[model samples]
Target chain A: MTLTPTPDAAASVLAWHDVSVSIGRTAILDRLTLAVPAGGLLTLVGPSGCGKTTLLSIAAGLLKPGAGRVETRARRIALMFQDSRLLPWRRARDNAAFGLRCQGMPRRQRLDAAQRLLESLGLAPEDGDKFPHQLSGGMRQRVALARALAIEPDLLLLDEPFNALDSVLRRDLQDLVRQTVTARGVAAVFVTHDLTEAIRVCDRLVVMAGPPGRVAFSTGFAQPADARDDAAVLAGLQALWREPAVAEALGATPGRRRVTA
Target chain B: MTMATTAWIGRVTAAFLWRGWAVLVSLCLLAALWQVGHEVYGGLVLPSPMDTLRALGALVAEGVALPAALETARDALMGFGLAAVAGVLIGAAAGLSVTVGRLLEPLVRFFLGVPAIAWVVLALIWFAGSGLAAVFTVVVTTLPVVIIGAMQGARTLDGEVLDMARAFRAPLGVRIVDIYVPHILSYVFPALATAMGLSWKLAVMAEVLGGTAGIGEGLSLARVNIDTADAMAWILLALIMLLSLEGLVMDPLRRRLEPWRATRGQAARERRS
Candidate 1:
């Protein structure tokens, strides 16, 4: 079955067609089909070991699918991991400029570009000189985000990048990611287990489940991400839990339990 | 200068002076102990520190000390440089592949098991009376240490970081230079330092046995002539050379290469503040 999130094929930046992955004797992903339209924020929410990360890795072209194809119209694809994964020896600016450096950009130009990105992400100029260990958790994530953006990627893949941060910091980074994606017109596939967070940031949501992981449920939110207040997010979460497939995929108890004594 | 730069300069000066003072006090205590030993054993066995210094001065005045010291330094440094380059390259290759690592692990252990004295004896036989004997012994003894360090560094490189690099589509050259080299150097440096000290000792030992024209040769001559003061002087010269090299060269190079590690405590303090 084809699961095209957006109708226009030409307008999509990434399309995973019948993607399947297996490790040794165990199946991880089973003929999963998903798509992300240009300038869209899509969240893949699922329980642990549900192949959400596997799907993202496949999207990033880090891993090959066992059977099926991943097609992307993106000129450059960048991935951000759960941990900041910044080089400890490199200063924040150097870490942010790492992708550009990999592309053979001259040091001065890449550093200037990184400096501008850092500033936009709410870092002081001096913060660029600080090593990864010296930066706070949020600041390090900002550097990682800047690194992803440094290559001017058309498609961005995030694997729970704010998982380690506190709630407030996580929310701030979520907003930052959302704003950056919208501003840059980049297609992003965000993988997380947090439903409330998934509801708050995504234009479209995908819930996956099973050892042979496949999409259990998917929906598009009518409300704009920026306009979704706390109450709206809570309401969305409550409504999502009401769906038996979503509740099962997330390993949460169904909202209405039929109590027959 | 800015206030911060001034403060930094003041701190560095103070640290240097303080370290120099401490070294002076320790040397004085050593000298005092040597004097006591001289008084007990007399001039035939152990010379007084002053007598040794006087003998060293005489050797310097006669233009014998500097050339012999330089000869020894050249041999030791040559072996150390060769071993450092070869060990790091071979070890990094082995570390990157499990099959190669397993194959080389037993070989490294075997080399390590063979004593430095054994290598000196073997080198003496192979190279005859040439200075190559001393150089060969130093390389054989020191190579194992550097190899182990480089191998460990390469083996322990962070997998997540490698994944991140791949996600960025880093080329092979970039991965090796920016990722592998720095991580490997962290492990290789301490090993290099250890190997350097070992190289000097092994070179001198080989020289003494092979009768090369170096500090070790001078010591051998002193032993044959029963000149305890001369022997003590040569030993003192060797110690001074080693200490100077370590202080003036190695430490500064290490700090320059790994500024992040050198300033870790300061970074922590800043974060706390």
Candidate 2:
């Protein structure tokens, strides 16, 4: 039977009900239930072993939960990874057009769009022509970000993509992503180790922590996302950190290899 | 020309000279050993190096050598090309499916374990004095090695890279062509070099055993007439063909096709350790 989603499905961008996952004997996420509204910016912040990435993976359909279901109304979704993961053989412009290319867009048109996207991302024409190995780490990351946004997804999944960048690039990426996704009214689920970045970017913050990771708590700022620069938002962010799970999540030195749920 | 290109040429020549010198020394050592063997065994049992060189020159002069050498070279080329195409296609299929790979592993091992002589016996019976028998032997023996190589190449593919391609919604055709083909190429090129040399040797063996009109047939005819130098001449012709094919054809092709592997010397070094 075919089940077609109508426009009314926009009530939520994504939802997980009793979702559980395990790798070997170690359970990653156990009976986790959560939902994010359409056009929402939700960030998952948690301790290293907590299943923040696992949850993100499940949401992206990269991994399936051992038990329970995941539902999403997002017509188009894109995931931007930590590493640029560009095809080494391809140039930066070609890499940025990768998603469009996958969708079978004509090469010339996609390349033109990719060129514009790269220019907007502050990459020069020459830089766009360069290969991934030739580009700087920050530049490669931006190309990755551009690749995701170039698809114009209704939902964007980010997994600590700006972790390796300097504070400036990180801030710049945060602002760019927020502006792009928010302006498009695209819902984005971001998983990060940086509590402050999470606090600033997300409309809602969810904390996950434990041996069998579950959503420990969730909260929102009384102020709007635009007023994030204001001191009141910082105080609101500080107040949330006082929560035991939020503090624990912030203190975690996440497993360099993988996060255990 | 630009100074950078001059510097690049200088570096290439320096590398060439270094390697060429070692090759020269190795050839000298081989020649010295040949001379020692002649001294111990006499000219009848082990011909003098000069006598062998003279016989080789005479054979080239006689004009039987060139046509025979050409025939053997053709057989090896055909066999190696066939093995490459079949191996990659079959190996890719095996790599894509675990059950198929598991089933293929034992078959590949068994074929590899069996000597080329046994296959020649079977081929001789099946094809009966045809060039097909010689080519078949070369293809059968060389095919398994390349298949194993290609399968290993495909199997070791980075899962994360595969994940990235999948998440980006890359079509099945795109994934295989863009991701699998390039990754497998790093393994296949090195295997092709080995297969080329092996196919030449096997094809010659099959020719000798089956009485084909090639280098091996010349060697057999020389053996019957007790012409040791003629046999040695045929051996030299075969060696030249093998080395020329590898150095002139395969190496240039590898350099042209696989720039990624050439550029990633540091990563390869790290892997070696």
Candidate 3:
């Protein structure tokens, strides 16, 4: 009954099948279906308050879907919250190693694993000894990311992981996340409000529509040319934004502003 | 070199003198009123502040007074320590589990609501004029406050933090130490300080009633001998010692706990992740 992952098993890591979620008397997600490919970065993007967070919560198993089913390859799933939820009392390294420690790993070994993962993620060797309050906003998020990464989860869910950072730091963290998860070949579902940021990091994009979230748009990163800054990508983005159903569901126009896709 | 050092010394002395003068002025006003009362009622009924101070100094120089005060202090410290440990453990258990909390909370409320004097009488009868009676009363007076305080600390723990702990698959020990302990320590220590004060007050009161060897015994002896000045003198010495001990023990502990307040404060303000 151990929670450790059996290695090299990635196919259909997590799936949400006809899942609908409700909070209190109100329905938030309406019959939505999504799947994460093994070692794939699946980004969920939508306008504000459009059940993106709810879907992420359900996927992380923090919130149970009101109806339908959620299946996953591994029972152990870790979610990195939007705000770095590092325990202020614990040092950066202890917080990082928290999940492994929970798995009943021995102290020195847990510390070693946590240290290695954190160092790989650009954390200084000494940084793990500092408490969360002593760390800045960026550093705390990095610690949180390290904690999630240390668990070596088969499935990782992130809720707007870079929402609070300045643009440069956000880009750096985005790159860091991509590099770390890709190296480990872990399945990740990253939720973001930005289109370009999603495009930059995620292999595929799944966009949720409205309050009772439905899959309004789904696309893969199959652009032959460099679509990040290309005129065609911008035009296609605009066209997607102008889709009558998308515009109606989300009140904001899909304006062509450079954002973390 | 001499001039500058002299100037610095003079400034420091002047600041000290100003603070001393303020305290001296208040003391003089109190003394003058006390003198007026002694003038009206005469020596036996109401003693002047100067007479009480002189009596206190004489009692201390006699050497027996210090040992008596120390014994009383030792008893108070022991009683407070017992109350604190019992209260926090019970409170944390009650606060963490709803079934335990609901079952035990009403009993605590009943004990807290019962008047202090009632417990003193009951403890005196139960322990039969022994030092245990006084200590028992002190515990009764202080335990409920500390228990309620620890319970409040436990209830205020952030649910989101617990969820984070769960997601990380933290063991029970880790959850309690890194998560629960830091959150509860701030609330527990301040309540402990207050309880220490309460225990001391109850200890003295119980001694006066139960009549054992302590400051309270001395106070009762003063009353029996009809020496009003000596009684007031013992009361004043007891107050000074209680204040001193609180500053000595609890103040440093509170200073160590200061950093935790900031984190708990932030947790209170945060509504969601």
Each model's interface RMSD (Å)?
1.3, 3.5, 4.1
Q: List residue ranges in candidate 2 displaced over 4 A.
A: A1-12, A15-33, A37-40, A63-73, A88-92, A115-140, A162-186, A210-213, A221-237, A248-261, B1-57, B121-128, B224-229, B262-273
Q: What DockQ does each candidate score versus the true complex, computed on alpha carbons?
A: 0.62, 0.30, 0.28
Q: What is the descending lDDT order?
A: 1, 2, 3
Q: Output the TM-score of candidate 2.
A: 0.77
Measured over all alpha carbons after superposition, the RMSD of each candidate to the real structure, in angstroms, is: 3.3, 7.1, 8.2
Q: Each model's TM-score, in the order given?
A: 0.93, 0.77, 0.75
Question: What's the residue-level lDDT of B6 in candidate 1?
Answer: 98
- Which pairs clash in model 1? none
B190-265: candidate 2 lDDT, tens digit per residue: 8888998899998899889999889989999999999998888889889988887777888789867765442576
**Candidate closest to the true structure, highest DockQ:** 1
- Candidate 3 residues A96-157, lDDT tens each? 88888888888899888888877877888888777777677888898899889787788888
- Number of the candidate with higher DockQ, 1 or 2: 1
DockQ metric, candidate 1 = 0.62
Q: How far is candidate 2 from the true structure (C-alpha RMSD, Å)?
A: 7.1
Docking class of 2: acceptable
lDDT of 1 by residue, B144-253 (tens): 88999999998999999999999998999988888998899999999999998998888889889999889999999999999999999999999999989999999999
